[model samples]
Target: MSVVVLDGSTVRSFVADEAAFSRSVDARFAALDTNGDGVLSRAELRRALESFRLLDGGGFGSTEPPPVPSEVAALYDSVFEQFDADHSGAVDHAEFRDEMRRIMLAVADGLGSQPLQVAVDDQGGSFLLEAAEHEEAMIAARVRKESKKEADGK
Candidate 1:
């Protein structure tokens, strides 16, 4: 038998890779972007969070969703605050993408070369890896922009 283990840095690098992160983000956004609008309204966000609460307790496939838990209800506010980086009360794809990038990169930074192997079971679902070129550029630019903002704010 052969075994291979990836360190935390390796896993972090995999997530930091712009293309890979964005694909995961994209799929998540697609599911959450109800009504086919490019932007996520506050209502859409609240509803999504409500759905998450139900799913968290094995409520999936149920005709009626369970009530939101108190913790998730509180988390809903913080999550929106984080996701809407500009706090404009709405999250467009760019803001959402940039915010996600910033978060993933920050986590990678905090991992700081620690060792942590990764394993995956696809379970037949697919993850799109080849993002549009402009998407890559957008992430890079947003990262730079947020970095500058952080620096300037500090």
Candidate 2:
């Protein structure tokens, strides 16, 4: 695991092993595949959204909620399409792993300047080290300012 610290209080960890990352992706996909139909349909995606909302301390009943935002729906569809490369309308384990690897590589490339390092402790916790580059630091500052402005408006 590698840790990225945004500030004194905000830190996040990322698994270093590609296999571990793939496993995590597989687990999430399995949890969201409500119908066990191999492919994730719109209904399954809705179920995933509702589940995530509940996990984030929101409320959702067994019945599906009203229509989701068009942008959100389109994003979901696009992700599924990308993973289901053969147009099989379903993503097998291998396909899922491959797509996950590609996504991870892209993310790693984006953060190339802030390279990640993994350290294992005695308690078996993986520690992630993330050192922000000049550009990343600037971006973070801008984001913080924008967030503060939004909060003040509220």
What TM-score goes with each of the models? 0.51, 0.45
Positional deviation of residue 126's Cα in model 1 after best superposition, in angstroms: 10
lDDT of each: 0.62, 0.54
- Tens digit per residue, CA lDDT, model 1, 103-126: 655654655565443333233222
lDDT of 1: 0.62
TM-score of 2: 0.45
Candidate closest to the true structure, highest TM-score: 1
Give the distance in Å from residue 68's predicted Cα in candidate 1 to where it truly belongs: 9.0
Per residue, candidate 2 scores C-alpha lDDT tens digits across 1-154 of 3334333211222334444455566676776676787766656755654544433322455455544577666766786788777877667767766775676556555545454433423232221222122225557889999999999999
Off by over 4 Å in 2: 1-3, 6-18, 37-39, 46-68, 115-154
Backbone clash count, each prediction separately: 2, 3
Least accurate 10 contiguous residues by lDDT in model 1: 124-133
